[model samples]
Each structure stands twice: as C-alpha cells, then as structure tokens.
Target chain A: MDRNGLEKQCLEVRRLIVKSVYEAGSGHPGGSLSGVELLTTLFENFLKFDPKNPKSDSRDYFILSKGHCAPLLYSIMAFKGYFPVEELKTLRKLGSRLQGHPDALKLPGIEVSTGSLGQGFGVAAGIALSLKIDKKVNKVYALLGDGELQEGTVWETAMAASHFKLDNFCAVIDSNKFQIDGSVETVMGVEPIKQKFESFGWECVQINGHDLKQVDEAYQAFLSHKSGKPFLIVADTLKGKGVSFMENTEKFHGKAPSPEEFEKAMIELGEKAL
Target chain B: MKKYLALREIYGQKLVELGKNDENIFVMDADLSGSTRTVLFKNQFPDRHFNMGIAECNMLLFAAGAAISGKTVFASSFAMFETGRAWEIIRNTIAHDNLNVKIVSTHAGISVGEDGYSHQANEDIALMRAIPNMQVLCPADALETGAMIEYAAETKGPMYIRLSRETFPVLFQEESYSFTPNQAKVLKDGKDVTLIACGRMVDFALEASHKLEDEKISVRVLNASSIKPMDSEAIIESARKTKLIITCEEHSIIGGLGSAVIELLSDSYPVKVIRMGLKDVFGQSGKPQELFKFYELSTEDIIKTVKENLQ
Candidate 1:
C-alpha cells in the first residue's frame, strides 16, 4: 500500500486502541497510540506471517518488548485476520485471549510473553539466532519503548545480538520521550540512543516514526543491512500520534479514557464507538 | 560403594552424550561454563553452544526463545543467579508459555562451600516450586544426575534440575537404579519410622537409617528426588506405615523436601514430621563437610533427629 492508504489504516488501528481501552476502563493509550504506525506498517507490509498458520516454518516473528502496548498489537493482529476484530473489545476483560500483556500461550501470533521490560528483546535475539543456526531466512523484529531502555537486560541483549552478528534481527525503539512518570530523559536519560546501539556494533537508523514513508525507508535500510551487524532503528515518535488531547501527555500513559473522552477520541479519529 | 563423584562432572558428561545423540539439543551458559561444566558440550558441539557471558537473565530468555522454536535447550548457571536473579523471566517466558526448556543449575545449596553465603542458593527450591507449571528436580547423586539429564531432555515443558558442587557418595550406583519424575525411590525398607531425603542428603539419610538399626529402631528411607510433582503417594503410604516421618535436604528446611513432604501429608494424611537442613540462616565460609556439620545436615544430625522424633 502507498503512504496515504497506510495512514488511513493507521488511523483505524488508533481508533481500535482507543475504543478497547475505553471499554476495558484501563490501558496505556498514550504509548499504544504512539506505536500505531510502527506496528501498522510492519504487520501490513514487512511482516511475513500467516493468518491461517501463525506458527508456520516459512514465516517471520515479532515480539513486543514494551508489552504494555497490547492494545496496538491486538488491534493489528485482529485487523489482519489473525483473529476476529471484535475480540479487540475484550482487551483485559476476564477470560479473554486479548490479555493486558501479550501471552504467547494464549494467543498464536505472539512469539514471546513480554510484560516485563527488556526480556522480549533477548527472546527475539534468541529466535534470530535459532533461525541463523537452522539456516532459515526469516527476519525477527522487536519493538522497545524509550523508557524500557532503562532496563539493563535491554543493553545486555543489544550487545549479545551484535556479538552474535545477527543480521536477521532488527529492533526499533518507539522513542516517544514520555513514560508513566514523566519524560524519559528527566526520569532516566537514554539519549544518544543511536550511538549507543552503533557502539554496540549495530547498524543504526533514525527516522520520524509517524511518517509512513520514513518508516518504510528505515525497514528498507534494515533489509539492506549486510555489514555483518544487527540493525537498530531509533524512530522519533509522539506519545499520542492521532488523538489531539492525549498526544505528548504522560497522564494518558496508563489511564483509560472516560466515556466522554472516548467519544471525543473516536470522533477525532473519524470512527464511532460501539 | 564407589568413591564420591561430583554431580556437576556427571552432568557435564551426560550433556556431551545428549548433544552427540540429538542434534536438536543446545547448551547455554553464562561464562560459568567451566564451573557449571557446560564446557563439555561446548567443546563437542561448539556451534550448538551459546556462551552468554555472565548474562543469566538474557541467557534464560534466549533459551526460552530457542526452546519455543523447537530446539531442546539446556541453560546452566549458579543456582543463585539462574533461579534467584532471573526468576521472573523464567516464570513469564518459560513456565507461562510451557516451553520445552531445561534450566539445570549447578552449585546449589550451602554445598557451594568456601564461596560463602553469597554464592549459596538456599532458596532455589522455594523459588522454583512457587512458579506454576514448573517441575523441580534434585538429583541424589552422580548416577541419578546422569539419569535425570536424559529424562529432562525427553520430558517436555519447563523443568529445573538443581545440582550440587561438592562431590558426595554415589547412592544410585546399583544397576537397577532408574530416575523417574515425581517418583520416590525406596532405598531402605523398615517400619519404625520413614526417612525422606533429596539431593546429596539421601546418602546421609541411608547412613542414619543403618545407625538407627543398631539401636533396634527400624527406619525406612525414601529418595524424594522429584521435589515439585512430589511422590505424594509414596509419602502418604510411608506416613501410614511408619506413622512418623523425617525429611532432609541441603536447602532451607522451610521450602525444600521437608516442606513438600509436610505439605502433602497435611493435606492427605497428617503425621508427626521432623524437618532437617539449614535452619533459616545464611552459611559462612567453610569446607563442605564443616558447613554440613555446622548447619546440622550431617548424618549425625539425621540420626539425632530420628532418635528424638521416633515414636
């Protein structure tokens, strides 16, 4: 799809995130909304996953290292026909496969269970290593939050991925600046993120995350990376990309939109809540 | 009985055998391959081994990823770091997903000796057992450790096998000895009292049983190697037959074999139980035997406890 068509689909996902969080009365809408385009583009364009057979051998794998953004992952998977789109409304509800965090056992496309920060990245690297060892050509992708980078395990995984020369692995940091408490820099600075990954021997790329074309180019560079190194894309993103009130706001990081606020969010995204 | 054999040595040797036979078997260690004895597999199958370089947390997650991707994975580190430091990662990724990953940790319990309290993993059993769907195994000696490595690879889902650093007398040197998950091996048969033990402490329990026989107090000994899915039927039968039970291990008395025995009996059939091991305290720098004596895990301690708690 072109950039314009991708943007429309991104808005649809953003609307789904808002509606699910609103119905569940709890979720990280801010971070979930920020990662819409990143996840949207990957699932729609780059990811080679089978909706019929989620665990097929000839398919690629993706892990959500910043697992609190389950709303976005579930929305994308549901929209892609992995499951019924109506299941998105059951987010965080009791006895639902759409858990608060991605559960690999409960859901098919989820390759790793990653509620704890920095863990999924290592798992992603492990899958990449396995694919390399098996001589398979499947690419492994992982999404990490800017605040989640504060975890030491993330750096450990970064160093290991590059040391192993996992060219099949690509990690993108949803650098949305804000965490639950405040700005990621004020809380715990992880600036010079690209240089950090570069020093770790990864091919680093920086792009405006909200721009679909830039996101596509970043993945393109990732695909072309064959300098005997892993790939890292540091995409600068807004905390809330689509909805006006929630953007760049920390209060919406983990709060569910009220019924009235949900109506406004749906209206802004050109959708109606059921 | 043959001279004592280091559990880690047998573990390392069995890993090589397992690796040679199954190409799907992969080994990982956190720069402690030499100490954990995963170096044997690393030497044999260099490409199949991953030296994770002192990163236990990431090593576990990596193992989970590989195991889920259809590889039989064995990850090793000291019990303290592998089970204590990276417990949540193990719980979330391996246990929650029910992935086929075997976390066989070495240097468990105060048997870590001169490394002192910091290196000892006194609470590893408790930490592993608390996780839902995790199978906890503690091999009694070198023979059982070898058998367990084979069984662990064959058995599916998340499993933890705890091994000690110090070499102890071989208990399962008999030709008929076989290791089975959740099954207690009755090493001695008597009726006055039943002695239940796991890990290296099983040898001490056998010693205690013989010494008690001289005093005309017959004792039955059960090697409770499978800690998590405990041999509850055997425990319940022993509770009924002997009417008194004594549990021993190298771990803390609070949550090791003793706790498992008491927990089972309290639910099914209650009996008078005496728990023996480290008494809720950290160990100091000492030789393995000296620490065992200091912590009252020696055979003399078991004999003493048996005498005191006997009917």
Candidate 2:
C-alpha cells in the first residue's frame, strides 16, 4: 500500500482503539494510540504473516514486549483479518481470546504471551537465535516501551542479541515518554538509548514513530543491513498521538475515555460516534 | 563403600545422547555451564547450545521462546537461580503458555554444600509444584536422572527436573530403571512403617530401612521421585497397610515430597506421619553429610522418626 492508503488505515485503527477501550470500560489508550502507525505500516508492508495459518513455520514473528498496549496490537491484528474486528469488543472480558495482555495460546498471530514487561524482547531474541541455528531466514521483531526498557532483562536480551550476532532480530522502542506513573524521563530516565544499543553492537537508528514514511524506512534499513548485528529502532512517539485532549499526556496512559470523551475521540478521527 | 555418581555429570552425558537422536534439542545455560555440566552438551553441539551469560530471567524466557518455536529446550542453572530468581518468568511465560522447555537445574537442596543458604534451593520443588502445567521431578540417583531427562524430552509441555550437587549412591540399574511420572518406586516393603523420600534423601531412607531390619522394626522405603504427580496410589496403599509414614528430602519440609505426601494422605487415608527435612530454617556453609545431619535428615534421624512414630 502507498503512504496515503497506510495513513487511512492508521486512522481506522485509532478509531477502533478508542471504540474497543470504550466498550471494555477500562483499558489503556495513550500508548495504544502512539503505536498505531508503527504496527499498521509493518503488518501492511513488511511482516510475512498469513492470518489463516498463524502458526506456519515460514512466517516472520512479532512480539509485543510492551504488552499493556494490547489495544493497539489487537486493533492491527483485527485490521489484518487475524480475527473478526467485531471480536475485539470482547477484549479483557471473561473468557475472551483477546486477553488484557496478548495470550499467544488463546489468540492466533500472537507469537508469545507477554505482559510482565521485558519478557517478549528476550523471547524474540530466542526465536531469532533458533532461526539462525536452523538456517531459516524468518525475521523476528519485538516492540518495547521506553518504560519497559527499565527492566534489567531487556538489557540482558539486547546484550545477548548482539553477542550472538542475531542479524535476523529487530527491536523497536516506542519512546513515548509517558508511563503510568508519569513521563519516563521523570520516572526513571532511559535516554541515551541509541548510544547504549550501539555500544552493545546493535545497528541503531532513530525515527519519528508516528510518521508512516520514517517507520517504513526504519524497517527497510533493518531488512537491508548486512552487518551481522541486531537492529534497534529508537522510535520517538507521543504518549497519546491522535486525540487532542489525550495527546502527550499521562492521564490517558491507562484510563478509558468517558462517554463524552469517547465521542470526541471518534469525531476527532473523522468517525461518527456511537 | 557405596558407588557414588554425580547427577549433573550424568545429565550432561544424557543431553548429548538425546541431542544426537533429536536434531531439535537445544541447551541453554546461565554462565554456570561448567558447574551445571551443560558444558558437555555445549562441546558436542556448539551451534545448538547457548551460554546466556549470568542472566537467569532472560535465559528462561529465551528457552520459552525457542520451545514455542518447535524446539525442545533444556535450560540449566544452579537450582536457586533457575527456579528462584526466574520463577515468575517461568510461571508467566513458560508455564502459562505450556511451552516445551525442560528446566533441568543442578545444585538443588543443602547438598549444594559450601555455597550456603543463598545458593541452596530447598523450596524449588514446592515453588515448581504450585505452578499450573509445570511437572516437578526429583531424581534419586544417576540412573533416575537420565531416565527422567529422556522422559521430559519425549513428553510435551513444561517440566522442572531437580538435580543435586553432591554425588548420590547409584540405586537404579541402567538396564532396568525407567521413569514414570507420579509413580513411586517401591525400593523395599514392610508392614510397620513407610519411609518416603526423594532426591539424595532416598539413599538415607534406604539405609535407615536396612538398620531397622536388623532390629525387627519392619520398614518400607518408597522413592517418591516424581514430586508433582506424586505416586498417590502408592502413598495411600502404604498408609493403609503400614498406618505409619516418615517423609524425607534434602529440601525444606514445607513444600517438598513430605508436604506432598501428607497433603494427599490427609485427604484420603490420614496416618501417623513424621516429616524429616530442614524445619523452616536456612542452610549454612557445611559439608553435604554434615549439613544433612545438622538438618536432621540423616539415616539415623529417619530411623529414629520411624521408631518413635511406630511407638
């Protein structure tokens, strides 16, 4: 799809994110909105996945290391037709396949079950290492929150990925600044991310996460890099990207929009409010 | 003197044999490859072996990742770090997803000797047994360790195999010994009292039974190797016949074999029971034999417990 087409899909995903969280009555919206374009562009342009055969051996793997952003992941997977878009309403409900966190066993296309932060990144490294050992060309990708970077395990994975020379692995940090407590900088600064990753032997790049074009280019660089080094995309994003009231704020980091707020978000995305 | 063999050494050798037969077998260690003996597997299949540095949490999650991708991953470390430090990772990532990751940890219990309380995993069996979809196995000797590893490889889902740092007396013959999960091995049978033990303590229990034999104090020794699916049938039968039971393990008395047996019998056939292990205390630096005696887990302790319970 072209840039215009991808931009349209991102808007649709944002609307879905608002609607699902509103329907669920309690869910995260800030980080979910921020990750809209990064995931939308990859699923549409790069990721080698067949929604029908989610467990196919030939497919590339994607893990949401920052699993609190399940709203965003569920929206993209639904848009990609992994399951009915309507089923997303059941998210976080009792007996729902779309758990509050991504449950790989219950939901197809979720390559790993992750919620307690920094775990999915390590799992992604393991998958990439397994692929390299088997001489398979399937790529492994994981999306992490800047807050999630505080977890010691993330650094451990970063070190292992580089030491083992997992060229097949790529990790994108959604540097949205805000976490539930407050901005990541104030909470526990994880700045100098690019330098840290580079020193660990990973080829690093900084990108505007919300810009579809830059997200595409970052993924492109990862696919083309011939250096036997893991790739890190330090994506700078807002805590909440789309809605006016929620943008760059910690309030919506985990709070669902009120009925009045939900209608406003839908209207802002150019959709008719329910 | 009884012949003693290192369980970790046998584990390393068995992994190489399993790796040769199955191309998908992968081994991971957390910088303790030399001590855990995964160095043996590493020497054989360098491509399939991963030395995951000193990070235990990342190693377990990595093992879960490889397992989910259709590989049977055998991850090793000292039991304290493997089962204690990375416990939440094992539960949330590996056990919750029911991945094919076999955590074969060495240096379990006070047998870790000189390493002291921080290194000893006296609560590993209890911790592992509580997790859903996790199978906990403790091998009594070299032969049982090999058989349990083989069984874990063939079986699907998450499993934890506990191995001791101290060499144990070889009790099972290689040709005849086979591991069946949840089935207790009847080492010897008597009507007066039942002595149930797992891991290194099984040897002590057997010794106590022989000493009791001379005194006409008939004792039954049951090797309760599979701690989770714990041979409920055998425990109940022993309880019914003997009416007295003594449980032993080289672990905390709280959640290991003794607790498992009592938990079962109390619900089914409640009998006079005495549990022999570290009674809510941490182990200090000492020789394995000295630690066992200090912790009241020696053969003499078992014999005394049995004789007292019978009275």
lDDT for each residue of candidate 1 in A1-274, tens digit (9 for 90 to 100): 7888898899889988998899899988999999988889998889999989998998899999999999999999998898999888789989999899998878888988888988999999999998899999999999999999999999889989998999999999999999999999899999999999999999999999998999999998988877879999899999988889999989899999888888898889987766
lDDT of 2 at B298: 92
Superposition error at B281 for model 1 (Å): 0.3
- Tens digit per residue, CA lDDT, model 1, B138-166: 98888889999999999898999999888
Quote each prediction's TM-score.
0.99, 0.98
Please identify model 1 stretches exceeding 4 Å from their true place: none
Q: Give the alpha carbon lDDT tens digit for every residue of B1-311 in model 2.
A: 78999999999999999999999999999999999999999999998899999999999988988997899999999999999999999999999999999999999999899989999989999899999999999999998998999999999999999998889898988687877888998999999999999998899999999999999998889999988887899999999989989889888889888898889989999988888888989999999889988888898988888777777
List the lowest-lDDT window of 10 residues for candidate 2 chain A: A34-43
Please state the error at residue B74 of candidate 1 in Å. 0.4
Say what the RMSD of model 1 is. Answer: 1.1
Q: Point out the worst 10-residue segment of candidate 1 chain A by lDDT.
A: A265-274
Each model's backbone clash number: 0, 0
Per-residue error at A148 for model 1, in Å?
Answer: 0.3
Model 2 CAPRI quality: high
In model 2, which residue pairs have backbone atoms overlapping below 3 Å? none
Question: Which residue pairs clash within candidate 1?
Answer: none
